[model samples]
Target chain A: MDLENQKRVKDLTEEYGPENVVVLLGAAEGEASGIAAETVTAGDPTYAGPLTGVSLGLVVYHVCEDEVKEEFDPDVYDEQVSMMEMVLDIDEIAEEMQAIREEYTKY
Target chain B: MKGAGYILVHTPDMITHYGTTQTSERIVNPESEYLKNIEANLRPYERVRAYYPNQTYIGNITPLELKEIEGPWQDLECPVDERYGKYGEIMPQDEFYLLIQAVDEFELVFLEKSFVEATKPKLEQDPIITPYVLGRIKEGVESERIDDMVASEDAEGLYMGDKLVGAVKKAHAFDPNLSAHVMVENLVSKASSALALMYAVKNAGIDRDEVEYTIECSEEACGDMNQRGGGNFAKGIAEIAELSRSTGSDVRGFCAAPAHAVLVAAGLVKAGIFKTVAVVAGGSTAKLGMNGKDHVKKGLPILEDVLGGFAVIISENDGVNPELNTDVVGWHSVGTGSAPQNVIASLTTDALDKVGLKVTDVDYYSPEMQNPDITKPAGAGDVPTANLKMIGALAVRRGDIDRKELNAFVEKHGLPGYAPTQGHIPSGVPFMGHARDGILSGEMNRVMIVGKGSLFLGRMTNLFDGVSFLMEPNSGPKEEAAGVSTDEIRRIIAQSLRDFASGLVEAGE
Candidate 1:
């Protein structure tokens, strides 16, 4: 994640309280999605961004995950995200998000 | 007033075969997946020509045209035949390759005999290239000589359709900075900048001889080993463009260099140091495929395939063109925080405060105009939109706009990011040509150009850098200064006092 987004996540978590915030990531690759999920929850794994050592432990999910997908209107989801869904390796992305959530998501 | 010209050189071969990202990755991992996928993802010249954003870049179509056309521009059908635009042209790769050699003064670039013979005529036909420039393309060397250098002399091969058409030889035996790869990259920058400068002169209706000075603000640095960044890119570009009366120097500030150079140019003109100053920048080979991995991973076309170049000619305000407001310039000091909001405030409100103008008073705000198509797949988000939102948030904080009006403010003031992610090229400078026209035509009253740089990229400083200035319709020609010197005034005052004393003595007698 870029520094601006990192700052935004941190600010939003502080503003609304950690329990109310959830990050929906739309990265193409499992690893990138996982890294971003880890960044918001466990601080930046790369140790190079604003989130470093400031773990929010907020809830996070990849947009490809079933938990996030079910919340969207099916028609809207199909219209907006179905093409990307067809190309993505959802199982890998979901597994990464689940792993990060299991390890670090306190809220 | 400053006349801006911009061009995009579609160098797919350069992106795939020689871009620093690809070449560096190849050296580290020759069979990288991105490299393997490159050949399949490369867009043909025809598709590149028809891409909507590209059409806008070369001025073949207006930004408003995109609003009517449904896009994902890659999938949009835009049949454009003309490569030229109001600002400049979108040059194809083959002609650009010949230009790269044409601009070379060191004879370091060698082209295959057959390839040059075939491409020379096409290059000669471009109106931008004068006969003098066309004559600069060397009679081609034998293919064997180029191939042997690539195999034995560490020369970087230039390829077209898998055939080696040219090679750039290393300038030194052991100097990494003077290596063949670096030479090729610098030559590309020089060539593209020269082309843009030529267009700027042509578009502005100014004689080439009128360009008295040039400031090159590209990210590329040209020099030998002893002085790695010791640059005369401005002079090199001037030489190629044949700006006979111009002398120049380079200014480097990462992505913010163009804004800085433009301000510097404006100041020079305002100070009467130069009657006309062209601030020019060429594209970077390193930046060509900077985001390829992200695009390729997402099953998207490699949109960062084109190198971007721009030239802006700053002249004495003619009372008709938009005047660059040097008085209300913004600077991001070392003390300024690097937070997004802070940076935006520094660039927008801080400068606006000087002129007693509210954020809403400005007609448009152009920040980092990085094409979202390129940045979004790379996980950078919509950069221009993000910038506008920050500026909008700042407006809300200052009560210049209500919180509910933030979105509307953004919608009104923001422009879509259409520029290539060529670092300095996208940093609030790309829209200058449009802004000039909009102001001149009374469509816009004021537009601010903001440039932001990441100083941390150099590892020399943690401070962020930025500069901004407003462009508004010229108020009118400035009143000329009174001619009398202070010494002359003093002498006249003393003479009047003496006369008064003599008159008083005469009257008393």
Candidate 2:
């Protein structure tokens, strides 16, 4: 398990109360929707810094055109991680997210 | 009357070789834990005769081969499950594909037999071998016929054979729509299992017009979410069965569909309404290996594999067996209690009370409970075993049977083999085929096929779990005739009604 997903599990357990909930995530998406949006593995960048009793999730921006699809790099989806970083990285993360979002819209 | 005629079904062989197990704890698919539990608890038929060895194959449902969407999902993506906020994380179609993977899909678990054969050309023939026919062939000329069939130059001749042909003809005469062909299906997802069952029935030679009712018990889903079994399958299946619309149309119950279907068949038989009733189902393959990853990732033993399908034909003729405990009672953890505690006790006590069988009298109790050894450590909490214990506790509490008797009961029943953890399919139905035998043989009097579904997980509020039960044929009055021929009875009733109406009219005037 990735540190991130493993951490998310811990967080969800505490947040929902283990007895009341099981760890479930709608991981897949479709055009304008989540395709097979069933589940995601533990290490996906979607969850970060979740610990002890905190549940966390990442909202993906849909950049729906083919031309825009070319501009995205899977490796750079670091907003969740940056959110946990010291205050300094917030602007950079936010800026990058905006740029990525803007680029997808062009297509 | 043929004592509760038992139909023992095993997952199609091709399926086991390639099928996957549904691992989720929820009971969304009909083949979830509840269904599996009933299967596990049912007794096996000792007199084994394989019928309809040929499998029926349905059409392919392969998705339009995935194409990269012209644009990113953001432009085209549809609103998705809230839990997944937009992340241009993956391909749009993959998202839909994977989302379906998570739930207990009906089509993926059970496959149609002919579907399997359709995939493999060499196994071209689909045969429906009944118990009586299997017995006669086995005793009379199986080897010789096999040789003759093998010797035939044409595959059709081989399969449609002089011997096989005769048998098929005989079956066709009895049920003219009966196809001597066996049905099979390839694994896609669990829903195919249910589809396969429907496909089998329709393909088996039961004309759509002759079929007054089509009871579906298998867990395959014909519809996507929201639509719910709304597909051309009814048409596809009807075409396969060659049935027409006037014959009527409908499905019954939740997971206990097959059992419900049987009761319907029995009722039709008893009520003198319909003569032939067919219970058919297809399981999904999607649930396949749902838990394999959890086990493999955690380094534990793998629990379930491929999905399968089955179809049973119930008729009123003395040719088939009849179940006596028609007084079948079903209950769930409703009104009287809550989870963990009430769920167990209420369901058990209520079912037992109906037949006046103490925990001791019930040959076995089926609760689509999880297999403790396989599920306990996964934080599942040993639901099946706990269910058994609850039954014991109830018996002791009621002063019906003592603790020693409880131990004896468990000992006699034994923990069934580990089943797929899919909440519904694995529950009480898996062992039903076997338990049915004991009922027919008179070795066991009252056996209950119980099913329970947990609704809370689906996030569908206001819906509590549901439970249903079915009793197999046990002993009853020998030759307890129907009292009157159904046709004649209907005719007489019609005449009496006409006279009564005329008399009333005259009195009014």
Candidate 3:
């Protein structure tokens, strides 16, 4: 992450607490393998540093892992340190994600 | 049943090749986060059977080939065991690239001169699609102009791998009204719809000028900030396909938009408002690889790569084609609660009840048929199966079938889902062309298309949305025309005048 975005992400994490701060990494505009707009939420095992921050880069967090996913490990994967794309209200983001999941979920 | 185009554009899988280390180098900050930790050795995406060539994807197979495909191409296995069938040929990536360029040309998507020069030969050599390319390609914009425009940030280039295939120039310089992203998206939407319409015109045996109106039901919004979602994807598409006499507009309801459009188009044709009306949709880029992470994790190639588009034409009931049973309409009203069972019952059982039809009366049900392969690894289970089982359960509760007969009911009524995950593209419209063929051939008595939407996504409302209608074999004799003919009016007027004159003479005497 750039110094400017790094500072912004740090400030956000401080304000919202590390548990609530979710980071999303967007593949640069022309990457061949990963989807250009693929997004992964940062948390317990997966949240690490050395994030990618480009245009439309941002952070989303203040997530309750229990409510959102049964499990999330940022550390098990490469630590993500992407630039803050957009810092959304964590609860709202969770609700939206949950809604999307429910669309395909059976009753 | 007019025509359908299920196209597949195979992309090269260079990006998915595992064991290749890719490093991004930044000069200013050599240790930039993007350079330091992006996944280097990524697995290459393999071409799946469904993506290669088959009847399910209308594009690889032409309308003629599609006509030859037997009904119920989807296997009826408990878990979908196969993705590809023996119906159509799989188009290779290079050919698809040329096809997309041809499509761009058809829509007047200008390319830099050098780019066109490099690509022109590849397009010419392809015997299969050469005719299409020759028929569509027009004049090219100079590469110098493209360079200048890109330098000035006035255009966005269309990239395939590292190659710059084409670019979208800004429609206007000072029009914040037309941002680059909006222009690009609209351009893509327009080009795709045009390709589908072209196929439809040929497949449906209808002249381009015969279409009187069109409805573009894609989820993409074309207009600017002042009127964000205000659109005419219909007019843009009609213009491209040379629908000389057609006029059009757009309707949006997320995934349910196509079903709503179908209902609207059917009503228009049945009411004699127009001889032929079309409901068309183009795919979305945002949805491409939407579930990629899960697929990648499970060692599965990204299946959502294809940008899906479809077009359905509703025309005058010619006794041979299937009729849109307008009376048997289902709606998910505002008060219809959001529970899954409630939604299924409201959109299916209740509507069928109103039409005096039992749950088992309909031969087939097409709900949100998102391909399970793409959703399953993502932890979103078999969506089509879930829908079918719910309908079966409802049938059981209504005494339409025994509890033990639910699996049989599903097997009889449902087919494996084959649609891409483009939100609106999969909502009950993919199977329309097949359904039309079945009904016309006397193989299917009734097929109901159910379109459901999550209205709360818009943040303005919490209510869920849905609309469904049945298509059946044309029970001969068209529904009454919406208005009386001029000759009928004249006869009525003449009789009334005579009666008045006779009454006047009698009173005078």
Best-performing candidate as measured by lDDT: 1
Once fitted onto the true fold, the runs of candidate 3 whose alpha carbons sit more than 4 angstroms away are A1-107, B10-54, B59-110, B118-148, B173-177, B479-509
lDDT for each residue of candidate 3 in B387-497, tens digit (9 for 90 to 100): 788788767766789978987887788856667787888898877877776675578899999998877777799888999989888675444532546575455345434
Q: Which consecutive 10 residues in model 3 chain B have the weakest lDDT in total?
A: B15-24
The candidate with the higher lDDT, 2 or 3, is: 3
DockQ comparisons of all candidates to the true complex: 0.05, 0.02, 0.04
The lDDT per prediction is 0.83, 0.36, 0.59
Candidate 2 CAPRI classification by DockQ: incorrect
Candidate 3's error at B149, in angstroms? 4.0
Residue-by-residue lDDT tens digits, candidate 1, B1-509: 55677898988888866776787667656776778879899888877777888877766665555545655577665776457777788899888989999898888999999899999999888888998889889989999999999999689988886888999999889899989989988999999999999988876667789999999999987777789999989998998888999999999999999999999999998898998999999999888888787777778888888889999988876545678998889989877766555677789899999879999998888899888788877766677777787788777767888878977887788888888999999999988887877786678899999998988888799888999999998786564213445574465345434533542353233
lDDT of each residue in B1-509, candidate 2, tens digit only? 12111111222221222233332223224344432442232211111010011000001100011011221111132222111101001111111111112122222211123322332232111122222212211112244443443344211111211122111111122331221111112112222333333333433234435555545554434443345445333234333333443132334344544444555666776676765555544444444444443444444434333233444444443312435245655555346434333454455666667766555666666665344434533434445554565566556656777756765665454334233443344556544443443454456555666565544444465344545455555232235444546674455345434533542353233
Q: State how far residue B23 of model 3 sits from its true place (Å).
A: 18
Tell me the TM-score of model 1.
0.81
List runs of model 1 lying over 4 Å from the truth.
A1-34, A37-99, A103-107, B67-71, B480-509
* Winner by DockQ between candidate 3 and candidate 2: 3
Best by TM-score: 1
Per-residue alpha-carbon lDDT of model 2 for A1-107, expressed as tens digits?
23344555556655875455423221111211121111121122222223322322222233322233346463332211111121122333334344433432222
True contacts kept of each: 0.00, 0.00, 0.00
Order the numbered candidates by lDDT, best leading.
1, 3, 2
